[model samples]
Target: MSSITSFNDSLMSHQNFVLIGIPGMQEKNSWVAFPLFVLYALTLLGNITILYAIKIDPSLHEPMYFFLCMLACSDLGLCISTMPTMLGVYWFDSGEIPFNACISQMFFIHILQAIESGILVAMAFDRFIAIRGPLRYRSLLSNSVIAKIGIAILSRGLCVCFPFPFLIKRLPFCRSNVLSHSYCLHQDAMKLACADTRVNVLYGLIAVMCTVLLDALVILVSYILILKTVLSIASRKECLKALNTCVAHISAILIFYVPMIGITVVHRYGKHLPPIVHMLMANIFVTVPPLLNPIVYSVKTQQIRQRICSILHLKRTRG
Candidate 1:
């Protein structure tokens, strides 16, 4: 027990970590920085524009737009979580992160990712309610009710991710402190611990089972039911129109979950895969969704698309 206490004490005494910044790719961060910077810029501009459009246009005052706004906020949070540190590593090779800051990043990243999943589920639920229970949709998911659902979504993510950083804290990281990704992630940090990590592994697995995995399964089931409801429509045109309405949400879900699944797969069974592959996959998991989410909605969502076009046209007229 004394040895265990000393090990825990020693781990707590350490307060620094090094982000290895993508093994063989760190040498080319300058070249990498340009694309990353551009993606970060697009992520910021795109999501912010969505929020701004939703804010200014009263036509977008529906439940769908409201959820899209929430989604935009989550995407923005995700971008802010890792952009600076990622740029620092790419532009200046500044990969040293304080232990606490790393933990903070890990916490927010997981929380935001979880929140994003929850939002997608809510969006799916909205579509479900709209299609399956169109007559009662408003009464079932009114403004006040939507607010409560939002709170529950955020609360669930907080409850699930709250223990992630603390779980890592209990482990003694006597192994190398170099992280392979541009950002701090739970798996990245846990992998560096030399001690027995079975408990951490179990907790992490349970968290995933309850959160992302469960969310994905719920999303899948929602879509299946959505498809069934759409199929019941008498007119084929109506069915097409209904499915078309879901294209943006489906895209958002795919962009968010597919890369995440890839990251998990790479971590679990890609031992023989190149280190660069894992790093690139992790970076994509962070960057792609934020970059693509707003674009998908802007292009696919009619009200937001029209508002954006009007804004651009007005800008052109002024210019």
Candidate 2:
């Protein structure tokens, strides 16, 4: 269409597009692009392998592995949804995203983010039942129960994240189109809107509070109960074993949530920090979690480790 052509023309006119206007940060050269491209490839391959390993291994057909599979799937979705566009912007210096494409990316990014939060909460609840009421965990967390919860998590994520992009669509973008962050994050993207974005901002805050903050609170509560139950077991060996199993999950949760909270806080209060600092924090928030999730879960879960070994052998045999 004419509009598309015009947009493309505008993008083509600029040979050097700078996101932050820093002296050296103008347009992503191959140096930055190559490293991120490699990281993205590894993240995709690692998470997808974990997903398939969970699916094919009979020994991992339990609730924990089921949730782990779901987590891996969400991580894949997260990486694919954000990384390509980010890398494109960095690599080609093509910061000119079509309006529709930007909106679409925003939708998927928010949805996947919400799903990750919900899945983490579900995983925490699974741990709570496993530690607090092992006898009932099987009955309470059956395949049917987990299936229903997964459906609900996906549905709720889509429902909550839908309004965010829709709200963004309503706002007219007359100001600069360049985004502060690598990808089109909702809040950062909204900053470029020439029209009033009070409603979008308010709605986004509500969604984050309900989906991210509320889920985090529930995860914390589940862990608190799990810790209490573990302590009451009285056997030092048993306690250590239980803690060891959970240590990886706890560490992953901390790594994922801490930086997220850091970004939120810095965006709100630490405006004095340099743009590069903000950019670095945002990159960390996206990259660190996915890369670490498979490492932690696979390293901690015995069944997954064995399954991975089996798969690697099967691949070798086939080759």
Candidate 3:
């Protein structure tokens, strides 16, 4: 009975420490929960709708749309894995997650993040084949090839994220458990470790550099090749159409990656910045891409916009 009581007391004390910074976490956070909630809800619904539409539409069964569906699905997973927990903590003051739950959140967040990175790389490759080798596009990126790429993406994501949770598990918690961010980010969580986290930090950084940064470099090369091919095309109309098709994808990639780089740089060097600034950058990195992806694709892709309108019309007719 004495040991149980002691354990309970220790748990309560840890909880108290974690809650201490909660009051200061987002004390001045603009109170935009309602808007953010609605936006996230729409993102979830919109992405799901896109995935379903592509799956069901016979005309949309090509490699490009197949990859778009995968992108939508990954974005949906990303938002679902991170946004709810973050919004709950930020808006409802329910930031007190158990240690295990926090670790789980960190794991899934990183998994989805890696998946997104891989999907972007796959999309860039898809565009490369379509533009540079148009005649062989269908034969090269067959259904089987796409399935193999999808499996590889999930596998790579799991492999990259495997070390993160394992490292977190080994860490001894001695300091305050209070996390400064709305969600349980790996680096932020590592700061609470009393153990030597040099290994964890090094492994995490290496995985990110290998996966995300390397993929970004490949994407840049693909775009450069694509630009050269486009410039060599004979007809101005074909060039404009090709460029316009790529514009939405380019915009989405920039919005997603630029803020991610900003967050990484700030986390590495701008530790002295105000907490609000850190929080704002984190929010931009997390929220903006999910919100902008569907919008950009819908505006750029006539098929997606048409399907959305058709779905809306069906709902209105039913109502």
Best by TM-score: 1
- Candidate 2 residue 208 Cα shift, in angstroms, is 1.3
Best by lDDT: 1
For residues 1-319, could you state the per-residue lDDT of candidate 3 as single tens digits?
Answer: 9988875665455432242223354664436567668878988987888887777678889988888888788788778877877777656766677777778878987888888888888888898898889999999999999999999999999989988878887877766778777777889888877779899889988998978989999999999999999999999999988887787778868877898898888889998888767777877777778877888888888887887788789899999
Residue 96 lDDT (model 3): 77
| Candidate 2 residue runs with Cα over 4 Å from true position | 1-24, 317-319
Per-model TM against the reference: 0.94, 0.90, 0.91
The clash count for each model shown is 0, 0, 0
Off by over 4 Å in 3: 1-30
Q: Could you tell me which 10 consecutive residues in candidate 3 have the lowest summed lDDT?
A: 14-23
Residues 102-188 of candidate 1 have per-residue lDDT tens digits of 999999999999899999999999999889988898788889988998999899999999998888888777666788788899988
The global C-alpha lDDT for each of the candidates, from Candidate 1 onward, is 0.90, 0.80, 0.80
Candidate 2's displacement at residue 118, Å, is 0.5
Q: Candidate 3 — which pairs collide?
A: none
Q: What is the lDDT of residue 250 in candidate 3?
A: 87
Ranking by TM-score: 1, 3, 2
